[model samples]
Target: MAAVGWRGAPGARGLGGTWHPWGASGALSVGGAWAPVGCAWRPLGGGRLAPVGGARLPLRAPERLWGRARRKNPSDPNVEGKRRATIMKRVHMARKKGERIPVMFDEKGQPEGKHGDELMSWIGVLAQEHIPIWIQDWRSRDLDGLKDIIWKETITSFTADESFWTACIKSCGEAAQNFRHDLYKTFVEGFLKEESVWTRSQKVVDIYPNIEEEDWVKFVQYRTSSQFQQLSDRGSEIRTNNEYSSRGGRDGYRKLD
Candidate 1:
């Protein structure tokens, strides 16, 4: 508790007025004039203020702010029910006669926008559809019969495709530098001709003898790769180095009798 003048109280300065009590001054601004605002006054000028109106102002207890706050109002369930009924009536009236409400399905055959209970299986719908197609493919059907070479054409048959690169871009998000480096390595490892590596290495050393060790390695790799080599010469176009020795005792077109 502290001594403070209660404004507008008896024997004290009312609104828009100052008080000089106990040689101390107390004032508040009201309509461009100084007034006392129930605040305590202290002495000034390096001297104790002598009592003017006699004793100090009475000690007033602070107001209880918590008790003055508004309490939350209780909800009216009937009003809430009326609001819900009105909205439902409007929604039903807006719908056509034969039109059914559209339902949404997730992986678990439950509605969309629903939480927790709407679970999904490990296998996706696309996976379920494609798995049977793969199981019944020509290759799988001919598994027990005479089999053709799966890779009749080499990896060089593939061209740079926008769709493939887009898929790679989707799979590899932000760390594009490392992804590109790995993609380059995959291209080289998958399509490069290992048979020509020795020949290409010899050619690289001959072409640039003063190259650094790392540069020499890169040069050999590029030379043996389909990116730098003529794909036709190194791929299906190149004939074997063997020659045909003819003359099988008879003429041409030998028949099985």
Candidate 2:
């Protein structure tokens, strides 16, 4: 014993050689250099500390925060997302309602009239009837006879009015010198070329039928007599009640009733 103080127990002894069973180690040794015992002296290991017990810390990147948010609730109303959903709903509704979206046509095939409804209606009616046969019977001619019939009809119809005849001649001016040439270039010319005995011929007959043969002969004789002097003499009287109702006033240019 260096300096045995006392022995409190059989084997426990103090630094002074005294027995003290309750004393720790060697009386917390002072002097030269004291060394810590047990875990108190353990290194912190590069300043890294283990997490205290409880819930584990999340290991996620900054971008992943949004992904987690979406997954958790998923009903967040993003502006862009809501706009796209609304557009899709409208498209679906239109489709379900059988709405026809208007399409613009190329210049060459553009339709005439208000939304082409009038033309379409006419076409539907023509499709449902035997317009060609009706036209042939009305005209009293085959396909080959339409040219003469049309010319004669136009001439006879306008021959009575000196004003109309003078107007045509004045409007046509130098072109009237060659009547055939001027007539050939009229809008009716294009129609005659495009329309056949089967299509527009029937439509024409349905709209404008020839007068009775007796009436026609009388009209022709009246037109041809003395350079159509009969028309000059009674041109005003020759116009029918229907014609008076039609072309008698300022609204003469309107469609026939």
Candidate 3:
């Protein structure tokens, strides 16, 4: 990660030959006569040729030059980390290559918004039922609270079986608004609004015996906001539009654009 420069031409006269330490020995050839002499020589590790007293060095080592080119540019590390994470997430979760998911379209062969209503309805149900449970889950650090609330609410309201709830949370991508999109957003916004609940709950659990409530809340909020709903929406839009465009629909691109 470090580069050093030295000062002269290789195999040239007066300190321009291969020099070694230990005895501070140097080799020089004058008029085809070779000679060895002892001197103080420090090996400048980076591939540069240095003059004995004051000579301009020439850059060497093709590998080092290429490595410098590949090194990441100095800028915002946070932005770089987020971008790298996003790419890895997509690659890890992507479906099999060359395998296509069927497209749903209207009779006119235009891509229809098939899942928007279903997605919105799911969001509404989640906003009403799941949100409260999620809040309580944060407040109480209770998995049972989330389970009981989701069961009572989604089951009774929609008459959905266990399969529905399981499927909803599992394949969040299938939901109309994409659970990743809606749920992550809701969680981030909710956490921002009521971060003290999470912090206090964690404190009560003795997870971090000495963590200050305000400091804990601030830390959690920072992480949550960095990977929130808007990112999910952006990712989903890109994915859905790409899928639609592959099916020959300009409409999807238009809508997403």
User: lDDT per model, in order?
Assistant: 0.28, 0.28, 0.36
Q: For each candidate, give its TM-score against the true structure.
A: 0.13, 0.14, 0.23
Checking candidate 1 for backbone clashes, the offending pairs are 22-50, 22-52, 28-35
Pairs with backbone N, CA or C atoms under 3 Å apart (clashes), candidate 2: 4-17, 5-16, 5-17, 5-18, 6-17, 6-18, 6-19, 7-18, 7-19, 8-19
lDDT of 2 at 129: 28
Between prediction 1 and prediction 3, the one with superior lDDT is 3
TM-score rank order: 3, 2, 1
Q: Candidate 2 vs candidate 3: which has greater TM-score? A: 3
Query: Which ten residues in a row are the worst by lDDT in model 3?
Result: 245-254
1 or 2: which has the higher TM-score? 2
Candidate achieving higher TM-score, 1 or 3: 3
Q: For candidate 3, write residues 1-257 as lDDT tens digits.
A: 13322222354322344442122345432223333433223224454533345333332321122232343321222333343344333333332342222324344432335332232233233432343312311323454555466455434333234544543342221221232233334334455566354554632334223335664455345446645447647766897877443211112222343
Please provide, for model 1 over 35-91, each residue's C-alpha lDDT reduced to its tens digit, 9 standing for 90 to 100: 344443332233222123433332111111112232111122233234334534433
Give the top-scoring candidate (lDDT): 3
**Residue 218 lDDT, candidate 1, scale 0-100:** 63
For candidate 1, report its TM-score. 0.13
